[model samples]
Target: MSKFAKAGVAKKVMDEARKPQNQQKIKSAISNFTNKNKGGGTGAKPR
Candidate 1:
């Protein structure tokens, strides 16, 4: 797995990895983990 700190899409990658239903969607995690951006961390969204 890619380093969460290095990747800009930590939340997107981790959130996808944490779900059980995403077992067959491992590629999604890779995609998110590799995504590049200049934005800051994506903290939990307010309810």
Candidate 2:
């Protein structure tokens, strides 16, 4: 209920929401794996 506690909580939440440096690399790896192994895009394949 105090201002200090509220500020600390808000700062923690904001920090968590900020993307880390490795996020893009991780995302790209996942995307590449899915594409190579499972046809990653959103399209219907001919049977």
Candidate 3:
């Protein structure tokens, strides 16, 4: 796609992300992802 098309898509995404509900959803998703990865360990077995 052209640069203009990319810019338009980015604008639309920014507008959608500016909404209160969308912001909350994004925050919740990030929080859940971080929580899920917290204290994760490598796959190595204990000696």
TM-score of each: 0.30, 0.40, 0.74
> Model 2, poorest ten-residue lDDT window?
16-25
Ranked by TM-score, top first: 3, 2, 1
Supply candidate 1's per-residue lDDT for 20.
81
Task: Give candidate 2 regions above 4 Å deviation.
Answer: 20-47
For residue 12, what is the lDDT in candidate 2?
86
Better TM-score candidate (1, 3)? 3
Report the number of the highest-TM-score candidate: 3
Question: Candidate 2's residue-wise lDDT over 1-47, tens digit each?
Answer: 99999999999866765667556666788899877777556567768
Q: Please, what is the whole-model Cα lDDT of each candidate in the order they appear?
A: 0.69, 0.77, 0.91
Which wins on TM-score, candidate 1 or candidate 2?
2
- Identify the leading candidate in terms of lDDT: 3
Structure candidate 1, residue pairs in collision: none
Q: Candidate 2, overall lDDT?
A: 0.77
**Residue 37's lDDT in candidate 2:** 71
Clashes per candidate, residues 3 or more apart or on different chains? 0, 0, 0
Residue 12 shift from truth in candidate 3, angstroms: 0.5
